[model samples]
Target: MNKSRIFRTLLGIAIVSAVPTLAHAQKANWQNLDLKSDSTFGISTEKAYKELLKGKKSVKVIVAVNDGGVEATHEDLKRIMWVNTKEKPGNGKDDDKNGYIDDINGWNFIGGPKESVNFETLELTRLVRRDQARFANTTDANVAEKDKKDFEAFKAERAELEQKLAEAKENLAGITGFKTALDAVVQKIGKENPTAEDFKNFKPSTAIEGRIQGILIQQLEKGSFKDFYEDQIKEGLDYYTRQAEYNLNLDYDPRSIVGDDPNNDKERFYGNNDVAGPDAMHGTHVAGIIAADRTNKIGILGVADNVAIMGVRCTPNGDERDKDVANAIRYAVDNGAKVINMSFGKAYSWNKAVVNEAMKYAASKDVLIVQAAGNENKNIDVENNFPNHKDLDEKTIASWITVGASGPKDDETLKASFSNYGKNQVDVFAPGVQIYSTVPGSKYKSLDGTSMASPVVAGLAGLIRSYYPKLTAAQVKEIIVKSVTKVNHNVEYAKGEGPDAEKVSVPFSDLCISGGIVNAYNALKLAATYSGKSVAK
Candidate 1:
């Protein structure tokens, strides 16, 4: 990454702690923070303390996380998780009549309340099957041409997946071998609970120690892979096992377990209320971000307080099918999830109509969908991404908002290098870069993506709704748009190996629709003035 760009982006900022100084206590108002201070360039979370987040109640709202399962029992996320009292745990009956049998908190659409796949591209498999069937036939001109194009696409995808699978397998093997050897060494050496670092520091008389040292050293250098351990290694094995079972083999009839045809539009009522799945980390983390209890000091503070996190596990490690997302939306809407946080997307969509109809369904229910503007650094205006409802039609959909990532520093580098952007495609920018929030396993970690940004905004919207409750979804959208901190400061652009690259600085306003970072404090404060009597608060 561009260290200088990052440094400049953060410019001058300090961490916000529990005890506030007099100067810290008296934070600049939002208007002043935007014009004079460079803190906005730096995400200004500390500045957010004084400027935006100080006086607000932890708004109670449930934001659905539709991604990989979260570590449900993480240290920081346990207290505030949503629970469904009506449904009995591990019951075979559909107690709620919501179609899902015993969904306690949320439902896993991929696993079907039973067996599911992992990290597999169902779309690629579909395309692959179609191509293979056509390749065998002496087809007509149009059929042959289409088949050729499809074959090329499939070939590329197959190559990528094969490489990824190979890598996963290799890594899995290495981890397994290392763990076995380490286990033997630890037994002989009379040690236990040795971290990778501990193993590295200790000198052993065996070749296994040297190999372990090499792996540990390599891991330490990467920084991002530091969390690896024997247990994590075993988890990796499970991941690969599922990958082999569901994704690679393409045995995607998981719906039979739930006793519903996933492909059939009318057969939507089958899943049970087993929200936690065998594992429920992803949805839990996403839920915690929206409504984990604040100031509990147990795990982490969520953006909103009063939400009932409705877990809808539609995403696996790979591409989520159109049907899953569509049905997930309908489920959340039907079950009273007012704000849906979709931190997932895919490159290829076989049935746009299914997703589009789901989007409309959510809209008609007066639910707002906060979708992540994908993580590719490229501009999305040129390329069409699946699950995007508004950009395709000339007519606009007001219920959906596409969020882009912004770093803590409020400058050009503020825009996350990985976040996809388009002047018209993305709705606004928010603090998605280096965001500290809840993760799986009852833990908290700082993740960076437009995925993080979407929920922050969703949480803010929930806050508005919690206090005002009567604010229409459209009105909430307007309130957020009108309440942004518009900045026109000159700053650097994307820093990487490319033409038109360098410190080619420009006005920050050119970057996004509002040209300003999201500030919950300002939005709520402004909305609070008009919130009287009109809203439910």
Candidate 2:
């Protein structure tokens, strides 16, 4: 997830992207299945329809996908897109005078008149660069009183930056060396593009040669793209290289392409209306999870019934700016989005106050914000995960939900291996493993992350709001939390940091506040009792 928060997941090299692999024409809706009959820990969506909502009616509910970007015109998404009614399409003028021209779909906070800012420096990298000029020449003794705290942060960031840079370079060397050896094996086989059969049948002279053949055979057998050299590993090479070159580079900056005043955080009306910005894979999948065309019967069915997806692009290839996130939330709320799915979070925040104020604004307007608990396996209670609900004093926000990833297993693997968990910070868990949903270009594939889980909950929230119009955002959150199907088993938990952390057995209830996977059937029943409204909107 986190097209906003990408990190290491590679063979031995620490790759920067958690790119979801392609699912070879998979049509299984395991996320919407039943636990008893299907043996899958799904949301009981199919059961909800047959048992409770068979003849019910629902009103339109707008669920804003505040993520990297979305394919608004995909075959499964075009019908349910949020169209800006007041603004005219293609006139080049702000017909609604909302400062964004021709915003027929939604606004893109990372875009400008001619282009969009695709990749940006992480908040850590930005901090290092911004403070390098003043702190590079000073030390603990010479730094001023007010600047002491900032100087300490700068030192920490600089050190972390150096370590990560070294690791990246080392990892890149390993990948390149592997490819060089792979080429040697291919040359010996006399095949330009070696197949599984070629690698399996060929005889190796040395032990190192046998190791290379074994690795290639394993990669090709994953059933992903067969060309491991060109498709899978090559993509990893390019991604990690770009991450090292741009995300970790202090000299590279893409903000100038957006034509914004760099010093100001108060500037709100800067980005253009390119809602589906450069890369739409991540956000498009999130949007499809909420509500693709369920009636079409051609592709897969979505989670909610009457959801209109509003794409508010903000997240980039690297960390998203706090200013963009704050503006994206405000834009969605002002434009009548009832539920916002923010499938992105970072390890640090440059300006939390602005985002806090925007969250408050959404709360004041009755817009519920759903966020991911990040992909790091560490407990967020000890580590930092931004865009959380707690204010400066640790007081919780009423209408916010922080989700963790749950899988199809019933035992130790119930929680996704890489999901971040917290009993206080994370609110609930949902299906996030091998989740089949829409990607770009009318295509479908299975992806993983709390990014996918968040939209499932958001879609449920939208469904509840659509059917029970009398329910408040806070009430919907309460019902969802209270109605989860609790887990009664202990699961393996990573007790510490680093790769070789000890695995301890802990009750699944201790992972998150809800202690279970979300159940849409139970939540709808709870909503009916709480609001004294059911079946119709």
Candidate 3:
């Protein structure tokens, strides 16, 4: 047989019967789990909880939540939160001497201390301003060439903004319609407060009522926020309205609302201590995921029971500024956070140096930063995502782990269709599909993305750090990477849509550097070796 035929034969054999190495068999046992079962074993979660908390020792590992502000007082989260006792509430003094006054937990970069801003629109405004100044019909060849490129980029952004605004408007209209129908139904059947069972019993006459039922069901799935739809609905309506108006408009500038010269990267000492900004949904949800009190049986269990979720609100409904992300990482590391979870990212970054500098600083402090790979599902090695450590040099600076989304189906096809991937860019994959975790205002919701995946890994990182406090950041990274289960399964890719059916399965080697899926149980077992400690059970 020729070489090509021999290779084909080998490939066929490999696909037909998996090459079961010892590690593969161990991982295979984990893959056999019935994901639909209530007591379904999450190898990572179970192992971490058991090994890391053997004696139930109180280990407070702070995980900085850098996207949005978290709800500090959720029923399941209140007990585990890290409160800044040095800074007295509403006293207007910088008691901790950490620059920001009254920072009881963390700072809100978007809202600043006094005002709010839409940072993405601010970047757009800057681009527009540059285009206007450079392209005002001077007819200089070189300058005109630069201006033309800038103008095209600006135009693309403007188009995107307009399209997003239009979509938001349509969504808001539907929400408004359903909300109107919901108000009438709740008033008639539920009086002031309505439960899921109450809404089920409530009758609907018009087509709008059916839509209202769907909306109510969605709110119910969020776990709570049923009794406060009047407040939650209004708040949501207002948020979407603002997003459509300011964030979606190419001309609008919310930077002025925050009183900072956004174009000047040097003017950084602005934002204040209002971590829980006008919108607390994403931050609160993230906080609950990392550190919600375990064994509460009230809402949901967080990944790390011993973690202190520090909410540094820097992201809005749109893109997070590089400056805010960099500063937030620095703050988290400096303030004693061992692991920082950045669940938000964008395709463009203006000042890459600022973010890179912060990443380096975090590395020096032995801090591990977990980032969301992205939601675009495109190969990231070709396209760049911001708040990343990678530069044109094609190298990551430190213990920065970029995570992709994984579905419950233990097959390559189960990967979330929107997850971004790259052999060099993304570090690993984690459970990110339809994850039931914490949200804001004492609620829980099912969200999907590498955003969810990053926290899961962060929880695992916290577990490793909790049990083996002596292990370094790099050691934890090695343990997690080495413990992952790698497979060469010929699985499905990008679900839904058509029959031409694009199916691609990466060789286990191509998915990430470690070629593995994160497993918390094995990480702890490995951490024991790294720390020179005996493996416990």
TM-score for each of the candidates: 0.72, 0.93, 0.75
Clashing pairs in 3: 44-520, 69-283, 70-283, 70-284, 71-284, 285-438, 285-439, 413-492
Measured with C-alpha atoms, the lDDT of residue 129 in candidate 2 is: 89
Candidates 2 and 3 compared by lDDT, better number = 2
Candidate 2 positional error at 382, Å: 1.5
User: Model 3: per-residue lDDT, tens digit, 1-537?
Assistant: 000000001111110111113221222222213233422324356554554546766567888889767777778777877678888898988888887777788777667545665334434444555555655664435455546766667667656656766866865675576567667887788456666677777678877676666556555644443333533455456645755666555566566666677667665567877777766766676666666677686876776767787878788766677777778888888788999988887766678898887888788898988888887667777777776555622223347788777666555555656677778888877776556666666766655567777888887788778767887776777677778766457544643223455767666456566666777767777777775643222
lDDT of 1 by residue, 1-537 (tens): 000011110001111111112132222211113323654432232344465556766445556666656544555555555566777877677677777777777777766545654455456565555555656554445455646766666667667667755755665565456567756765654655445566566677766667656655554443322234422444555655555555554445344555566568655765544455654544555566566666575655666656666777777655677777888888888877788888877666767888888887777888888888787665677676667754444222577777777665545566666677777677777766555556655555554567777777787777777766777676677677767777668756564433455655667666666767776666777676675433222
Candidate number with greatest TM-score: 2
Error of 3 at 415 (Å): 0.7
Model 1 regions lying over 4 Å from their true place: 1-60, 70-79, 83-92, 113-119, 138-259, 390-396, 489-510, 529-537
**2 versus 3: better TM-score goes to:** 2
lDDT by residue for model 2 (69-185), tens: 889889999999999999878888998987888888898988877899887888788878888987778988899998998888889989998887787788778777766776788
Which 10 successive residues of model 1 have the least lDDT summed?
Answer: 1-10
Worst 10 residues of 3 by lDDT: 1-10
TM-score of 2: 0.93
Those runs of model 2 whose alpha carbons end farther than 4 Å from true positions after fitting are 1-12, 15-27, 187-197, 224-231, 392-396, 495-499, 532-537
Best by lDDT: 2
